[model samples]
Target chain A: MRRLINRHPSRRMKILLGALPFILAVAIYAIAADARGADGPDKLMPGLNAITSAMSRLMFDIDRATGARLFWADTWASLARLGVGLGISAVIGLGLGVPVGFIPCLRALFEPFFAALSLIPPLAVLPILFILFGLGELSKTVLIVFGIAPFILRDVMLRVAEIPREQIVKAQTLGASSWQMILGLVLPQVFARLISSVRLSLGAAWLFVIAAEAITAEAGLGYRIFLVRRYLAMDVILPYVLWITLLAFAMDYALRQAHDAIPWTRFKEGG
Target chain B: MMAVIRLDNVSKSYGETVVLENVSLTIEDNEFLAVVGPSGAGKTTLLRMLLSQEAPSSGRILIDDAPIAAEPMPDRGVVFQRYSVLPHRTVIRNVMTGPEWLAAPFTGRVMGRARAALKSRARNMLDRVGLGDHATLYPAQLSGGQQQRLAIAQALMMNPKVLLLDEPFGALDPATRRAMHRLVLGLWAEHKMTVVMITHDLSEAFHLGTRVVAVEKRRHDPHAPHRYGSVITTDFDAKPRLARQIARAPA
Candidate 1:
């Protein structure tokens, strides 16, 4: 029923659903390559079929990919990277952004400096990160972390700064200490906005990880797709691309649901 | 009880322009002192100085004979002109915040019996203010009058010795303002806390204050140093007639 349709797909299911396209392309190529023979125009058809067979095959794969072991493992690898990156960013952003935002002199000295630093594309830092950490998980994580943390810090800092001045003064009058002001007055006010910024950073982390994986990884879906591209095996590459899109879609949906679940935002602003 | 607050030779200036000059006043225990002044007068500056949110260029403000210092003294609470209830927390939480923060032992930790007691005191204050039904509601959900009442409850919850208000009803409609005035007066009477409020409305000052302090320009100088007159305290003894007399006087 509608309940079945609305139930959130698991990460494994989403990725398998994504790779279903490659499965169908392989089947189609197997059939066409057998019937038309690679001596004629059949090789060209597989290349064309890689693109056209992708959409319908991905759709069919959504419900059927639940049983694959590698599918689940790849989903976990990507999710673990995302989880670690986002978790680290949230902690660092709150720790740094709150004080920097609330204190005017500190904000004046640092905000512009962070702004200037964030302007450089995160992917461009890959060279420096690899040179420092080499081709390890640390380098990949560092790229994703640096890619996401600055944007989150900037966002949270602005949100903290924009809290109504009256709220701060009111807290002060109520005998809130400096620490209590940050905890009670500032954090609650900025919590929703911070969650949103985290969502954006999470999405950015996923995108950054794909690029990171393609370059240095030998195991992730991005790595698998890059490996397949070497043999002009559109069949494997196309499926992995579809898998990534499905994963992104599912992750975005879950985060949005989490964002909506926040009780303060569920109630309207003036209500 | 001793005079709870004493201000001596207090002067404040924004750059070269003087706001208050050599102003001196003493507030007795449970005294309701309303300060009335024209626009741009230093009434608010004087209140801020008393609260230690601002320091005078010269002179001193003492509470229980101790000078107001950089650190917040638990004996005072201030209600601002704006309705500043945290629009996120419930009314009870907002009311409890003051007492829960300043009271020792519990102040260090907002858990267990301390939190439970805070909830009880906050609920009782809200009930007293007739906002018992709305205790779980946010500040945004309340009417302006209700928010002001909640502000009052919040201030009183701390059991402060001296409560300061800056035009608590200034932004409300006439009917709402009058109702708030009565409500505040009733709370002050019940709690017997020293109250100091600032307002431009002469009638409001006379209606609420045991004594009204008027701030006016004692001298005008187009050039050279400007001099502000000391605060003139008018004891009304809770009489409305004296307010009329002051209002009837020619400018």
Candidate 2:
């Protein structure tokens, strides 16, 4: 941040430049919302008051149907589903990727299949997942895992493959078994790439989960957005969109920090 | 008399593209054997075969009068022209990897007495290679010469019976190369391990090798230069300092 500020004209200028676009966006949104509201009180653009009221209502008001804070319920449900889905993806990606990249036998076995799999649009298989796994949490999680696992796997494989052959030879001469070579040499080196891949695929993971939830679900952020769409509740939708963005941003930032902290990865300083 | 390592009519090819053809060599224990040849003359291929990283298409490589195994063993240490050290590991850790990995097949952890013994051993090797002060630093932190030195130390840590060097000093500056030459000679004298070095530098081969072999393509037709692959063309004894040392020893 210090370097960033110094490279700009001044710290104050940097801060102003950073905030200007966002402030401009907010002002434009407010004006548009107000103008539409003025022309039609039932306009689709919900003014600040409408968003504030919706947020408060969503935060505090207990649903008569379930006696739960619907916003929190939706957030929790989506979070839990995504957590499990992405967890499975990381495991499959890291587990299969390193071996396939390092060993020619495994590469021949799995690489072509994954290469073909990655090409197939994940959304095209959504209906199949629902049919196979059935329309439950299982199907939703499966959709997300299917959506991002291939991407993560490919990223990890490429990273592992990029490790110089000389290093592999050196490891072999050091008396490392194939397993030990993978564990000690490849695993730690590919970790930062795995983190980067996970972050990259997070967007697609969210897309699949939200699409799955929108089609069918009892309680989720996506379900809530799609549910309120019938009522044209832009006030609820906008804040929810912002909340999701904020969550995704936080996750990306956290992954980036972890990537920076690793000294051996190509992302690290002097690397 | 049993030869420590032997190559019997070894031939290697990638489909039609032959690299090495019908090469026979015998390596006695404690001999410093150097191979010199032009690029594409199969010097690297020969070293790769001995490391068991590549297989000869025909004939065989034998160690201790038995056919060599498919996998590379810690009994043989190799230093490549480049990327011999894993950049992620610190110098000490890089040297210690052999012992730690060997221990893992049994203990799964190099701990208690084993870890201490390995550390001391690694430190000793590091000191021998003049990297005692930089043990905790990563390979990236070291200069190219220093990194190569560290690699040499790492290779020596397993007490390998055969030390194979593939132009290990090729990347160093001239002065550094000379220093490395002296260092390698000292290490060879102290350890008495059988060494096989593949080099393009004729001087390095002569300076270190007890025996030097030239791998050259025997052109069947002058018009068709690429028709034949590399075979042992010249096999001769080098300046034998080891012989002098043996003669001077009080028997």
Candidate 3:
């Protein structure tokens, strides 16, 4: 028999090990809800059945006033804001970051300023953004852009700068002009890194979008969560939080798949 | 023989540190010149000066009896010890990059019949370097020897007047290095280009060069090492022995 430290689990055992904690947490929640008594007024931990029934109603029923499903409406609104904000950030990051990193004059001029911008706490400026853009879609989208754009830009700049000097010289010897170098040599490497930078920034992007919606929004995931807080609607809130987690995980997984599709990204430099 | 490149009292210094001093030499067209020196003797700095990547602090360099350009141009091709090939491009594309840039300045690519011509030329160059089968692979996917071959192919594709190599095969095993020596000698004879190769290996210098030049510092300061810089100390003709040896060696 192998010692415990040296022992490794089989594939089936590994899957079971990964699932152990989630099952334990659900079991604990069910037992606690039973102990509190199903008929009790304490709504802090609603039973699983109540949460499921609430989710089904949100999914299947239409509101009489609006004649639209609330769940889908909120999800679509939040996704749109996130998408528009990230798209703008990606454009700005690629446009400014490539030149700034490749050209020394531009790097000297803008690198310090961009660094300071990234250091600024984006949440602290939320009130200013709201005042300037008004409490509308523009403000929410700007908030997400403000939160992650600088970070993405900074990552792109550093990556471009990190390209080996030898490669740059080789390209120059091959008769590449400044424009040609940016497009042929620098842009391809920076584009791959930008995908990774965006993937890493997703968590912060979600945070900013949710905060903007919770403060003031007609329809969004965060708005709905905040709206039901007065009634202690844990049954709806719990399921919504889980749904948001699932959505974020799916997006992250999809980006990873896209990144893997580019074959050269997986190539590691060998000496 | 017409002189292809000439260095006139060239000296380079960085602030308090002097790297090369008063180096003067002339290279003939179609001559293979191998430079050998100790570490920190500024052999690479000399190559950079020839490549026009660095301007001499004091002197001027001439090519075809005219001053060398301020920046690197396609007339001179170079391969460094490492990072010589673009990792993002496949093997054949790396070789095609030179002509593609020359033909299409903005896009760095060609289309239609031009593209096909460039691809065929690149393929031919790859075949000469023995990398024809690995043309679809990335540089990172290749072994050290294969990567060096790819770098050589990429450089040769431009049909440069002067080919500069700085320890191109320094990272390869001995067997691969010997193979590369034969490949480079064959290429040099075929292309009729003046070649300047810097190496630490003395035997390699004697084996491949028509003429061998050695650079070293004449004087050293005990307290301040940077007070003096390296200069060309030895230059000799090796073509007689090299010719005799090559005639006997198998291709």
Candidate 4:
């Protein structure tokens, strides 16, 4: 299996594989267009036409709108919410999870609570959140943080716990302190796993943010989606969904690249 | 020279299982001592007790005439049989971690001075291990011998007076193991550090250890049984020859 991946395909083969999906999509679109003549695109999907049109119109708006456009504004707002949420989660997760993971007693005491909390979806507690914080970015951001923190925390904790006891013993013999064991020895190895966990939890947090914003947001991409949905503007809804997905994709890609490009790649092989 | 470590009438057990019994040994400063035995012969258990990573159920362990109460001292360093090198750090970073941990916190001057000193010290040690060129490489990128060198470098980072090695080359192939043996000896001779190593390979113990101690099952009297018989330390010239000689010895 490794040999297969290592065997580099030629440029021509690469191009063919890269173009296959687009070629298929275009072929399908063309055939549908030809099948339905006058209102071919619409006729291709009678019920879904409004969705397609609404999406196209929203795309048009996003492209044409100039200063302080809602699209860009919502994008930035959603990104800000995600950033705050992910950052809070990262800090809190690592800070608490590492110690819990290192100490077995703490793990026994706290892991169950975290596990129980994680099982309850953050979205399910939206009413309580709305009652407390109302329809604001605070509620939505908090929702994202809650959604991701437990999952990320649990993963980081497990990774930390899995650090070989031998390594800890070695560090102890070397006269490393508790913090040194964590930062110099434990954290370095756990960082990669933690980063991966963050990435995984980021996707969950994004999903939760959208759900949260849909219910309690005055602004954000989810709010935009909600506003468009009120009038059955499928065009706007589709584009909003696309934007959210694109944002998630971009963030995830950026994270992976940053992780890969780190100079510490010299020390560690895999997360 | 005074004995850096002393274990007197030391006995250890896990629940009902007795691991080591009535074990007494003195490791002098600058001595390279190797404890060798068959698998589960309590050689590792003795090393663990000496390292202060584990406590004997009964008896006392002293380091520099002081009781080893908690973890081993800053003056003591250890290399494990595997993964002694932190995989996520650079080679130099792994070596420097010891000093950096010991340095003052939250001050630029302290950190800066420590960093410079660590860099120079780590480089010198890495060069000694013949790994100067691979300072930036991860342990995974290095060969078994090279990773062992990195592990050795990490142990030496603090200029420890005592270095504990637990089967350092146990996992290496014969050729790499032989090369590592030479490397360790050279390091020991240069550093003149006290080394207490555990090995299953009798030959390795004889070659590297100034005084090789053998741990093996002994006949128990059942009436007043001791878990371990007397550990016999031989001045084996070479580890491999020691293995052959032990094999020839009567049971």
The candidate that achieves the highest DockQ relative to the unseen native structure: 3
Model 2 per-residue lDDT tens digits across residues B33-101: 999999989999999999998989999998888887797777788998888888778889999998798
Off by over 4 Å in 2: A1-16, A40-42, A100-104, A266-271, B1-3, B106-108, B220-225, B241-243, B246-251
Ranked by DockQ from best down, the candidates are: 3, 2, 4, 1
Quick one: ranking by lDDT, best first? 3, 2, 1, 4
Report residue B129 deviation for candidate 2 (angstroms): 1.4
Judged by TM-score, which candidate is best? 3
* Candidate 4 docking class: acceptable
DockQ of each: 0.30, 0.45, 0.78, 0.41
Tens digit of lDDT per residue, candidate 1, span A1-271?
Answer: 6687689879999999999997997788678755765565443345455455653453335434344344445557777777787878888788888989987788899998889878889888899999999987888888877888889889889888777665676677677887777777787777777778887776688788888888987457766567667777665565666678887777778778887876556665541
Better of 2 and 3 by TM-score: 3
Candidate 4 structure quality by residue, lDDT tens digits, A66-120:
4445666777778888899999999888888898888778888998998898898
Instruction: Choose 2 or 4, whichever is better by lDDT.
Output: 2
Runs in model 3 lying further than 4 Å from the true structure: A1-7, A38-41, B1-3, B241-251
Off by over 4 Å in 4: A1-11, A33-68, A103-109, A230-232, A266-271, B105-114, B219-251
Q: What stretches of model 1 exceed 4 Å from their correct place?
A: A1-74, A100-121, A221-250, A267-271, B1-3, B103-116, B216-251
TM-score of each: 0.76, 0.89, 0.95, 0.83
How well is each residue in B1-251 modelled by candidate 3, as lDDT tens digits? 23389999999999989999999998887788999999999999999999888999999999888998998888888999999888989999999998888889988999999999889999989999999999999999999999999988998888888999999889999999999999999998778788999999999998999899999998999999999999999998988646645764667
Q: How would you encode candidate 4's per-residue C-alpha lDDT over B1-251 as one tens digit per residue?
A: 24388888888888766777777777777678888877876788787777777888999988788887666666677888887777767787777766666674322113566678778988988888888998888777888778778888888877777888999898889999988988888787667788999888877887778777777666655764444443443434333535644753666
Candidate 2 vs 3: which has more DockQ:
3
